[model samples]
Target: MSWRGKRKVEKPKSEEETSSNKNPKLESSDDSDNLFVCEISKNRRVAVRSWQGNPVVDIREFYVKDGKQLPGKKGISLSMEQWNILRKHMDEIDEAVAENS
Candidate 1:
């Protein structure tokens, strides 16, 4: 007598079920939608404020690993669209600085 005959077989999960368990949400947008790029440490925090004394946002987080960019734990986050907007205005800021200098 074969011992296999006494063993019970398990059914495999469907592809849809397997996928759902892996990634529950295929569409999600949060921090990736904001404009808060770049992280600054306590020591380097002054660097951010020194930019032409212009007003801007500064986000601090503890989850961010050293040497890592923003969007870190408590760090700023920016979406692709937000980045594009800033990039477009960079030329203007550069021009203003050049004129003043």
Candidate 2:
């Protein structure tokens, strides 16, 4: 008296599909192509990202979570003009740091 043969079994995935599914980070993705982010120092990063079809740069500190570096809530986003102003200030800041050294 057996009655357990009415469910449809799922087809097994191919090796490539299985491997890709197992490691999603290795898949070819272009979602981040519009955003450029990099670490400037420990716990610090600079990101050039596009928002509303406009390019913006952001500088901020980051934190580690789940063994990955994620952007922190504290950050500054700058427009092109603001970025230029920041660059000028950065040059002065660099000289000041060098003078102190």
Candidate 3:
């Protein structure tokens, strides 16, 4: 007898079943002072949140570990001053991108 013939066929799961297994992390907690959050990709996000007593813009990459999403080391937190400077230079940045492309 061929061992391949003894394999069991598994039934396909429904959309609900498949969807229930996917747990996306929340942008902020109940007590968190997050102003905004935007997902740029499946694992990358940009968020404005309060740190200590000051607000900072955080651009971070998240990873799934033990069924939970955790921030990875590949990220940067910009202070308000830095964020403002970046915001002011957006037009120049756009021009550079347009030129490069």
The per-model lDDT (C-alpha) reads 0.34, 0.53, 0.61
lDDT of 1 by residue, 48-89 (tens): 111133333434343223443222234343444555687799
TM-score of 2: 0.54
What is candidate 3's lDDT per residue for 1-101, written digit by digit as tens? 32122222122234353235443333443324554355666677676666767888888777776666667778888999999999999999999999999
User: How do all models score by TM-score?
Assistant: 0.27, 0.54, 0.67
| Model 2 alpha-carbon drift over 4 Å, by segment | 1-33
TM-score of 3: 0.67
Best by lDDT: 3
Candidate 2 local lDDT, 1-101, one digit each (tens): 21112111122234354334232221113233233344455666565655555667867676766665555777888888888897879978899999999
Ranking according to lDDT, highest score first: 3, 2, 1
In model 3, what are the clashing residue pairs, if there are any? none
Candidate 2: the clashing residue pairs are none
Worst 10 residues of 1 by lDDT: 43-52
| Candidate 1 colliding pairs | 34-78
